[model samples]
Target chain A: MRVLGIDPGLTRCGLGVVEGMVGRPLTLIDVNVVRTSAQLPVAQRLVTIEKGIDAWLDEHQPDAVAVERVFARSDVSTVMGTAQASGIALVCAARRGLPVALHTPSEVKAAVSGNGRADKAQVGAMVARILRLDAPPKPADAADALALAITHIWRGGAQARIDAALAAAGRRTS
Target chain B: MRVLGIDPGLTRCGLGVVEGMVGRPLTLIDVNVVRTSAQLPVAQRLVTIEKGIDAWLDEHQPDAVAVERVFARSDVSTVMGTAQASGIALVCAARRGLPVALHTPSEVKAAVSGNGRADKAQVGAMVARILRLDAPPKPADAADALALAITHIWRGGAQARIDAALAAAGRRTS
Candidate 1:
């Protein structure tokens, strides 16, 4: 299954695509950020983000999508922006009829670094090690996106099967 | 300034654009949803979303964008979809260099209905009453989007001043 992971943000939304089979190694297809200028108004910034994401989605179509859940309590504005960013990712995936999964930062960190409380550097190192990349993914955000994808790949098998079952049942009921 | 509020979703992303000056009543320019079917791949869904948003932005040219924050905890899949939807909305604003703001559901409810715990119907009624509309905005989601935009308009003036100050300081330092 191919999975697209996203770390959503208003200024810099990170995206990573990975492909894997149930019992095989995962391959990294792409990683990048959809960035916006802080100087711009919020509406214009959103336009840039929409276009960039559209281009990326067109270029690398994945079977499923995964995104980090934002749960910050400190800054309401930041949390709100993160939530909006997350919504955009969901809309993009759902429009395509691709199934989506959400993982918390801790869940991704645990799956990647074997510790939920692992720091960014640790998670980054582990992701690079697992992907056998010559260098760590740049801009912490990109690494986080990759880790999210990896986590989904590790746990997505059973979920996919369950979804398939549910879909079949729904079809029968309909 | 005009603020566009979006309630992002996979199947139906609600959009409401409201124009207002600092001390004047807000005007609702438009409200609608860009809907897509579940039969398509994720990539096609994203394309549909991009086209819808791009067209909206081009027509409205909003100064800022506001979106509803998702806080559901029930289904992981649903949350993931909502997050992605939010991401798309943010990207739409960011691409156009517009400043984006987000408001939690509770915050928007409070702003519109004078109670954070108000239900959708109550909030919708209040929005219609405040905007002096002959009918409540349809699709519940559309009303929520309008409420979010109003909240941003109410709060954005001071926030913009603060952002401007920060930008000036950063420019001097750089």
Candidate 2:
């Protein structure tokens, strides 16, 4: 399966695409950032983000998307922006009829670096090592996105089985 | 100045544009929704949002944009999507060099209804009264967006003064 991972931000969103199957090594397809500015109006900024995501999707055509789940905290403004960005990603995935998987930051880190508390540098290094890249991914967020995709793929098998069991159980009860 | 307000959401984002000076009654230019479906892919949904925002901007040419600040307390996946959508709005505005303003939900409620704890209907009714509209804006989110813009215009005067003070201080120090 091809997975597109996104790290959403107001000014810059990091995206990574990888192709692989369960229990197999993944191939990195592309990674980049969608950037906006503080000076621009909110509507225009939204447009830029939308356009960037659209272009990426058209170019990569990943089978599935993995996004980092946002945890709420203080800084209401930041949380709002992050949530909006995440909504855009989900909407984009839904628009294309593609399945989406969300992973927590700790889960992604643990999957990539064998530690949930692994820093960005550690995670990047580990992603490069796992993907067997000649160099680390450019931006740290991109690497994190790649790690998120890999983590989803790794965990997807068990989750699918559970989902199947749940569906079957529902059918029997109904 | 013309200000665009956005109530960002997963399926439908409410948008409103108003034009006026600070402390003066504002003119409503437009109000509408940018919608996406669950069946579409995440990337394509972003594109739809971008196009919607761009079309609004092209038609209205608002000088500034205001968006309701998000606060996510539950649903990690949903929060992430909301953040991404908000980021798209920020990016769209920034690209156009229009200033972006953020308002908390309470701030907007207080501005429109004089009660921070006001419900949606109360706020919407107050907005219609304040703007002298024939009726309250349709869709609670749309009304909220309008209130957000109005609040920004009202609160932004103080922000301008603060900015001017800082500028003067810098000049004196220099």
Candidate 3:
């Protein structure tokens, strides 16, 4: 399945598209980052993200979307912005009736690098090797976004099935 | 000016509409909460919020929008959801070219209750008294939403002007 991965951030949102299936070689369809000026108002920054996301969804229609989940941070301001960006990504995917998956940072790291505590350089190196690229994607966020997509393609389907089974067994999760 | 205040949440989003100006009596045009089942997928939950916000914006056609600013809390999951909802509210306002205001919980309390550290009960009481309602709004979220509107009507305009000036001076804030 073709999957779009998003590393949601207010100032810089990373988008990566990959196409593949279980036990199949993955193809990097595209990778990009949409940026918004901090000088702009909060609402306007969101508008920029909305437009970029809308355009991406239209141009590169993916079967599923994967977003990095935001958790509480010591800096409330930072977490708030990340969560907002995540919300925009979720809305974009849902509007098209695409299945959305949220993977925590550690999950994505482990999926791509086989190490939950892998540093950024290590994760980037592994992503490059996995995709057989000479160099890793730039701006870290870009590679992270790709990692999220790869993780979703590699693991999300199985997890979804498990969730479905659990729900069937009357142990639904939010 | 007519202001629409949103207390953003995943399960229960509070929405309130008020009509008035600074240093004047305010009128409560409407107050309501939009709820979504936790059983739904995260993306679907966001879609529900998006629809609710879109409808409110369309129906009220408010001159401005005010939303509660989310902060870091002990409950990471809860804060994440709240922040995401805040992002949706900002987008709903920005899409329509309506200026948006974000007020912190403390700011709202200070504006409505004359104390930044006021408890929810105190804020609720003040909201009811300010709007001349028989009692406080049913849910605390509903009252908080109204309080946000009252704060914006009474304080946010000046802050926006100041921010605009700062931006023009090349000292913009995020």
Rank order (by TM-score, best first): 3, 2, 1
Select the stronger candidate by DockQ from 1 and 3.
3
RMSD versus native structure for model 1: 8.0
Q: Number of the top candidate by TM-score?
A: 3
- Residue B135, candidate 2: alpha-carbon lDDT: 95
Every candidate's lDDT: 0.79, 0.79, 0.89
CA-based DockQ, model 3:
0.69
DockQ of model 1 vs. true complex: 0.27
lDDT tens digits by residue: candidate 1, A13-126: 889888886567788899998888889655565566556666777898788789887764425556656666666676667666778777998899998898999999999899
Ranking by DockQ: 3, 2, 1
Per-prediction tally of clashes: 54, 50, 0
Candidate 2: Cα lDDT at B124: 86
TM-score of each: 0.58, 0.67, 0.89
Question: Which residues of candidate 3, in runs, are more than 4 Å off?
Answer: A73-77, A157-174, B74-77, B156-174
Identify the candidate with maximal lDDT.
Answer: 3
Question: What DockQ was computed for model 2?
Answer: 0.40
Please give, for residues B49-125, the per-residue lDDT of candidate 3 as tens digits.
99998998989999999999887763675888888888999998998899898888888998998899999899999
* Per-residue lDDT over A44-67 for candidate 2, one digit per residue giving the tens place of the 0 to 100 score: 656676678778889999888898
